[model samples]
Target: MEQTQGMADETRHPMTGNRLDAEAEASGPGFETHDYDVVVIGAGGAGLRAAIAAHDAGARVAIVCKSLLGKAHTVMAEGGAAAAMGNLWPDDNWKVHFRDTMRGGKMLNNWRMAQVHAQEAPDRVLELEEWGALFDRTPDGLISQRDFGGHRYARLAHVGDRTGLEMIRTLQQRAVALGIDVFMEFTVTELCKADDRIVGAVGYWRETGRFVVFNAPSVVLATGGIGRSFQVTSNSWEYTGDGHALAMRAGASLINMEFVQFHPTGMVWPMSVRGLLVTESVRGDGGILKNSDGERFMFNYIPDFFKAETADSVEEADGWYEDKKNNRRPPELLPRDEVARAINSEVKAGRGTEHGGVYLDIASRRDPEFIRRRLPSMYHQFKELAGVDITQEAMEIGPTCHYVMGGVEVDPDTQQSSVDGLYAAGEVSGGMHGSNRLGGNSLSDLLVFGRRAGECAAENAAKHSNERAAVPDSTATAAADAALAPFAEEGGENPYTIQKDLQDVMHRLVGIIRKREELVTSLTELEELKARAEHLSVEGNRQYNPGWHLAIDLANMLIVSECVATAALEREESRGGHTREDFPMASDEWAQINLVLTYDGESVGLARQPLPVMPDDLKELFD
Candidate 1:
């Protein structure tokens, strides 16, 4: 590969641009350098939104992603974005949406964030439409809304279950139109800081394995989640806790690390595709869950907390779908944490299907055309992947590792991290979803916070324009050496073997349900895995090597796995995603606390912080 030099432009100071190229050359031979006001990592919905916002704020921005520009994990979202648009129901508004989100998260959410998200989400969705996104519409030619779990009314703005694809398309097109630079297929391994502030980042090109450095004052992390740490997951391979681990290593804190949501409806049959997601739209549009004995078992699992708003019998539950104004919601539309635990209990009681899952039946409940029109992705996903025609047969569904409700701790107003120049948004930022995220909230969260992070970062960059931070030669050299270490070792353990073992450990010991002994054992096992990952060996040279890529990603997985297991052991209560079998009830004491994790150069440390109290004005909405 040929060496690439930093570009000189009006936005870049001449002395600073020359210093960056000289430092890149000193780091190693053929090192590529780029200079920008802000560098946004992970080109998903949040990253793209952040880049566009920064550019609109008069800052030169660049986006770096691990995959192709449009192939982010956001494209796999099958449900719609949640916003209180009130298009289908006049009574629906931001206050009702805020109440539903807080209750769905079991009141553990940051009050200001939930408020901001609910108020801003509707506008963000409208902004996407203005940028050329065509959504499914109602008879009145308004954007149609659909029902989702834990929502009060028809609140999701969808494009026939392919809403994520539409969102990414709209954001990517808008960013490209503004001429923001994009670096594709680049994996950032380390964040370089100067005087305890973010200065730049060091990474390598996935295709040619050459080193590249982005010298920017501000860095925004939008890398998605930590789902890949488990064995069975709906997340793609890129969701390896990269943002979480990077923030911690760069002296930032993570909160609520124990709350990993196991979405209740993933494909269960066809072992090759066990963790593939079955969108909740199947139920939102009138599907039902049944056990092997043909019993609607969700009715048996309704907790006292939600009993006032949930139907008690089959007749009322069925009637609620058509007459939502007069009847309570169906038990199947309960929050995801409640539904997932119900499925686990049924399976353990021998009421599960032949493939160890329950039946999600829409064929017997709705017309065939309705099923196809509302859930086209699911209809084809089953037909092609598992040979099951969802339109005519009940789909086998079970809980799978989905989103993590914990990540880099940031200020609610600015999206800035504890570190001076670091910012986080979307799923990578914590305190937005609290313990468990409701269906359809993830996409809206991306837009609302992604824009805030971008605007704040651009302002910070402008304030420090004359004092551009330089990446030290020693720091750049160390990052390059770490990438090369796997090939230098002979007769070491294979990176693939270590990764599989790590996944098994996380799934079995730190899964949806937890016990004190299992969590303790998981911590011990994670320490062993960490030691093994340090000595991982890959066979081929670095050019397009999958093994080397996995080797680099294992370090991040191990770090985040430890955070999950450690926090799960400490929170002795059952609430949302962090369920404890030993302490099966939600504790008042635990509800007031949030677990926070920080990493020094050597080890991860855990501490407790008080949950933010909602003001009396916002608290009255729940009443």
Candidate 2:
């Protein structure tokens, strides 16, 4: 770990005092204000990386997170970060990674962003290594890469199954060492704009619910996915689409809002941990998917898109695990969208476990020691949560909402959103993954785009710092009033009940398999939810009030759910993560179209835009 800067020399704010855990109470009025060159909202991989990059570029940066540092959602990521280091497969390179990404998204991905991610991911992984991240190593002393869906070869640098933990730790250590100001457990409610440009943000402390202002020329929204909108999800409560809502409300366009990736293997038997993740590493490490009859089911569901590379026969699939050079990759390791659809089909066909899920069996395929060694967290998670030892028995797994493939539309070159001075990265920024994101790519996307977002945000801040030294009090006051509106409502629906109903609506109507009628119904239901949310009333005071927080988060979830439903209704193709049972096949016309959602002051509107054309050199890879 790097040494932390002493308190004597570090930047200090009156609101924070000299201590790290500073607190102030404000119930009715008045709020503290602070200023920074750049404010990064979120403390996950993307936010941490962005803050670190901004600080390193000679900018005063701060990170605002809803949870304590190190407790961000990134720590829950079990599989490795995808980077084409080619340690195991010497022939693998960026072109192959890029090709796989575009193909995995069914060619709906932003070509330039895909190219950039493929080209820059290797260096980002190496940089993490330099910052004291020790990845699994090969016999040759290079970082050992592992197989993952969509990638052509062994190309993920991991630390067992706790790769995200290691990554967040390294980035957190580096950020703390650099003395970047972090307001832990701070939930940003609104992005405050002055002079028609983003100059700061208004949010309340999660501990006290006291509104605070972070004045900066630039803001980076790295707050993650909208998973909590769905009933079954691998997302934490904090993943309620705060960043997406903030950006949309601040006048930025969101792309691909309809595409939500339902990870194939989530714990289903134990009702309490139903949405908990079962890492893709299981399949990458030679696990097989089966139905209740013990039939290898994934083999029968291989789509034509993956037929060339995916093995059809059990012999070839099993052989590929041992010898990748001579045999094809297993169909079980297909991209997340395909695998999830297959699993959903199995369960709906009555070929599922008692809990309405298919079986993920690695126990019968691999030795117990190997299972325990490679997947320690998963081994313990199943053993403790489900009372089933994964080393001895199969895990009952089903699709759960994992990630969003759509978010704030940004320029691929600079990571700048449609709204000036506002930037986004990670799952909050769209166009990289298209209609679906492959496993392992999420981490790499964070690193590659987070760095760019930070660098570009810093440049913008430096250029505009002289003009944006202070945010007007009118803007801050309005933001605070809006945030506290829930407290004023006397009789209204409970925020939690509203949230739960919204989740039910999303899961039932706009789920893994979407239909036009269902999507339309979801949109209408979401409008009703939004109306209820507008008058939501909490029972408790603002001090450490979870009810107030939920009320605020509910508003954001409603906004994001509206985007998902609207975009899903507009796009009529079954492609990648946005599977339309009504339009049950990938359409060439829709392939060329990308849905763009904009908050046009009064209402959110959708527009159809053409996909970015790939350059000849990059397009040659597919040919």
Candidate 3:
């Protein structure tokens, strides 16, 4: 299922001009336009899966992305997709997986979404295989399962350390095979609406200086996370909160935006490679965490919440690696929030490596050959980037900005936002993971909800089949004019300067450990940054101009950063990813509550809402 010439050609869309005829009579100068039942923004795992499902559901579909086909940020996912396939543990099932997810999320998760994700993930994982994905197999010939933090059993279906590469390649091949229209390297800047309903999305080509539109009844926002808001992050430039900002401007709400996950094991050496993800698979397959004095320190950091299931001594932790049934799991394998806090505490107390990091040592734990075969990417990444052989020496690792647990709030069943015709899924959509996400669950969550969003979006579009919503021609023009404002100003604040200042503010004030004073200061500084954002001036024209693109992205990041800080300040409890040093305990009062954010044109509004009740059957599984 290689890409055909039509798909491979980078910058050409014949259908773009077809809308010129339809809008010619309505407006004076018609911008390039294409009509579709559904237009999916951000061609990552979620977007590709959504497009495929929409096409199969008999809807005219299109896929638009900021990067070329198969180069999505999802390819950075090194571990596997989680699914209770029972490949290693015979007693494992969707019930157990669902319960584990809720526990890992600290009971703040949307129970129904967790149940749906756990139940449907195995089928979706197998579907990738049906579409010709080559997964590492178990000895009995099923897809191989491996250990990850929080899961009760070994349940991630992976292919060495490159599962995301194989998954994106497989889905990209399936998408091209189905002939789904793809607009590669296109940046969707705005989602236009007719009244309260979404009607179209407007964007510009990154390779050229032209604006394009995808006028549709429905638009699926599969655009990923807002990790770039922090100075140290694993997300790429494409993850500047485009989808989150667009949804907010369109009158959609975001849930639990305060909860941002900091992965415990990012590379912390050679300044150039700092914050690059050193996958948790390094510890998932029997790696150990050590302090400067060669002491296995994770054993001492296990909290009472997980103490029942975690080993408390070096001997127990070491033995648990080989005999999981007789012993408990190692403290190093705790949920991400717990482990990240432990690592942060260790480093702060001066037990860290020379690089302000802890040591992840696999050389002394696992065999060299086994390490090479299982962690080939980790081996190469360190060797090529930091000039260290991970097979022979321990690597410096620490917490870094990774994933956001908050995003566009949507219905768990339909994946549709409060605003009609606008759907969201994957990392851009919120409420599935609550405050913290388990490592492998993100991939499985993409498949389950991406497909659901596509089908529901298509169905929503079909309801309007007789009379399609029409966006005002002036809306796109205004958006385009606003985008070009940065280029119009001769000398103003540099966008890079504004962006760097914003990232520093977020990473310092609204970071992993927060306080009331820091959050207030962050909010005030964000306002000043917003004022400066108005005068964002880039030196070059739109053609291949990274500066102009970043100027547009800056506005989104500013809005998203405000939401995160505001929500973090409002939640006066220490739980999951929203840890506050001042209020350092989980509150039962806040357990049933979720914070929501929305913009009403003039100002942003925040509210508290009750969590949906878990069904009796699901509740029984937890009990």
lDDT of every predicted structure (CA atoms): 0.89, 0.87, 0.87
Question: Judged by lDDT against the true structure, how good is candidate 2?
Answer: 0.87
Estimate, for each residue in 1-623, the C-alpha lDDT of model 1 and write its tens digit.
23464335213223212122323323443567778999999999899999989999999999999988899999888789999999999999999999889888888888899999999999999999999999999999999999999898889999998999999999999998998988888899999999989999999877667688789999999999999989989998899999999999999999999999999999888999998899999999988899999988887876766655335333544534322233467778889999999999999999999999999999998988998888999989999999998889999999999999999999999999999999999999999888999999999999999999999999999998999977887788899898889888888989889989999999999998999999999999999988888788898666678999999999899999999999999999999998999999999998899999998865789999999988999988867
Location of the lowest summed lDDT over 10 successive residues in candidate 3:
17-26
Clashing pairs in 3: none
lDDT of 2 by residue, 1-623 (tens): 11122424334335444222223332254566787999999999999999999998899999998888899999999889888888888888899899889988889999999999999999999999999998989999999888888777889899999999999999999999999988887888888786678989888767656667788999999999999999999998789999999999998889999999999999997789998999999999989889999888777776655554435334544533322333477778878988899889988899999999989999988999999999999999999988999899999999999999999999998999988899999999999998889889999999999999999999999999668756677777888788888878999889989988998999999999889898889888888887777788887666678888998888888888899999989988898889888899888788899999988654679999999888899888877
Query: Clashing pairs in model 2?
Result: none
- By the lDDT metric, which is better: model 1 or model 2? 1
Q: TM-scores of the models, in the given order?
A: 0.95, 0.94, 0.94
Off by over 4 Å in 3: 1-30, 309-327
- Estimate candidate 1's alpha-carbon lDDT, on a 0 to 1 scale: 0.89
Question: What lDDT score goes with residue 57 in model 2?
Answer: 86
In the range 366-433, model 3's lDDT, one tens digit per residue, is 88899999999999999999998888999999999999999999999999999999999899999999
